[model samples]
Target: MNFKSLKTLAVNGKQVIVRVDFNVPIKDGRVIDPSRIQAALPTINFLCEQKCRIILLTHLGKPKATHDPACSLQPVFEYLAAILPGVKFAPIVPGTAEAITRSQEVRPGDILLFDNLRFHTGESENDLDFAKNLAALGEIYINEAFSVCHRKAASVSTLPTLLPSAAGFQLQKEVEFLQKIMEKPQRPFIGIIGGAKISTKLPVIRALLEKVDYLLLGGALANTILKAQGIAVGKSLIEESMVSEVKDLNLVTNKLRVPIDVVMAPSVEPDALSQTVAVANVPDEQRILDIGPETLELYKMILQTAKTVVWNGPMGYFELPQFEQGTKQLAEIIAGLNAETVAGGGETLEAINQLKLNDKFTFLSTGGGAMLAFLEGKPLPGLEPLTIE
Candidate 1:
């Protein structure tokens, strides 16, 4: 939980390797979401102010170590070049003779963004020797990629051990804000936890139940929970195996608030005839995709009374136009509230962007898996390596 801050480190005229999360969405070879890149600017700018030769380490997409052009960081590099004039791109990745020569050639204030780290299988395997090669390129290591901090990759995990490591500005802020919610959030705290499945969110959900007053459920997890109560969810996505676990959870927790109604359809198609139906009245062939209008109204009233609201995951299948309404409406409602709000996860970010309500929340966390892990009171692998003994 404790790590050195980047500003506290002495990196004047040093080659600093910064692990940033530039794993943004790309469409037709163009970066669609530059929020991750923008979030990293403060630390990158600060490193430049300290006259550090900023060597940026990041992965774009899931590449199978073949240096696939489709999974390239070239668009990100081009964006950086436009925003940051004179930024350099290494011709080769680490572990090569040319990469070694390139590392020595960088001057202070110069920026060097290497090719995708995932291009080498060693990065994800946490290969210490490969980490050592990466560390050899810099005297200091900075991890600003809290989104990927949950991953035990060589660049984020082992590389920090070989060099002086510090948490980047964005990461420090993420810890501070998320810690605020976990430790001492304001009175009448309301948590809205939803997503595709109950499996991925189980730990955080259990953790939230201990802290939040009213925990509202949405998405397919709500369907699974409903199924446990013997309610007919039609042909909705239900984790049948997790039904018994939900029964046990219900016996323990009274703070959970499930959807009273849901938007149902015969299929997941865009043109599937949708209808708002009571949770108990869903037809045998209908799939539940979104929260109903009544549930939205209930959530709005509950969110309005809260002093602090912590939200994660979309309330519905927001990527689909029909199912986006519930998530969209709730986003606007939260935007209008005076609560000190905090949100995390990729889908949550997507919803926030869909509504352009980013400025309304107190903190829109950059940490994804790291944020969830932190919320669950668990230590992150990428962060553990940065801690002082």
Candidate 2:
């Protein structure tokens, strides 16, 4: 569905309900990261300028029934005050008439943030009564929360059915950018798949094989592959169950590139004795925390000639200094690439910052699970319902 813009929805000084992803980390009752808040500015600013009465809805950390002060939207209000100082902020609790009453007071250029939507069990259950009640707040709904698009919640999937819905700027950008990769990526596309478990990344791996010219494996997932190839992984955390399956998969895809060498330590501890070994032989006591030097050079060589690159996950358990080399070097390679580069996943996102290459990549996605689900060809519940506009 071709969604109307915010400008198209705000008619007759209507109350516009916007669904946003304010699920950012909080530390010591303070917002530690404001990146998600920053991403929503364009949409918020546009609605305000249109003179629409704006009411925003979002959910924070998981909370039980009734109000939990810990999961309150107070921190998000505080964050908005800084990034959008001129906009007024108010908090509304879901499922209460007070929320709608408070929202009615918002004038043009004003903003009101609702309390944590999860406070009501109906939000996740998609209760029709709860959806209709939320629908009462506005005549129009705008979905700007791409991070939770995979979820079917009151604020994301259900509410849009009660009002004329549209896609917010960030959501639109996510669709357009990801569509490029699926449709017509540049030639010799290099796909780097990583992350902790083989199970989580299996769909993306299968998807990439159909389009990627070269597929490079890393992180804990690579450990399984290494073991599948008769390598002694040592004390490295290897999934015993996946090793045999990977060996079976190898028979179908000869294009898969597993690490040739790796950096290992007796344990993940920093001071542990570190050494490199060929993929064939690793000490039984030492764990393979990261990829080794030879593999880094091989990956770098592949990146140099690629016309497109898509990456997910980190190459190693990069939180520790001993195993950070693989992820760090991979980040450097992505930053220096002459190709069109796009990367996602939480660990990879953190590694990009640690390597100081956040600004160098073509695009760094804010959604991890949503990104993977999109590549897997799954419908995004948050986006699907909002398409009715």
Q: In TM-score terms, which candidate is top?
A: 1
Score candidate 1 by TM-score against the native: 0.96
Query: Please, what are the lDDT tens digits per residue for candidate 2 over residues 247-359?
Result: 76562454778888988777777687778888777877778878999999988988898888988888888888888889988899889988889888767877786667878
lDDT of candidates 1 onward, in order: 0.86, 0.80
Q: What is the lDDT of residue 126 in candidate 1?
A: 91
TM-score of each candidate?
0.96, 0.89
lDDT of 1 by residue, 307-382 (tens): 9998888888878898889888988898888889988888888789767899988889876678888888887888
Model 1's alpha-carbon lDDT is 0.86
- In model 1, the runs with Cα more than 4 Å from the true position are 95-97, 251-254
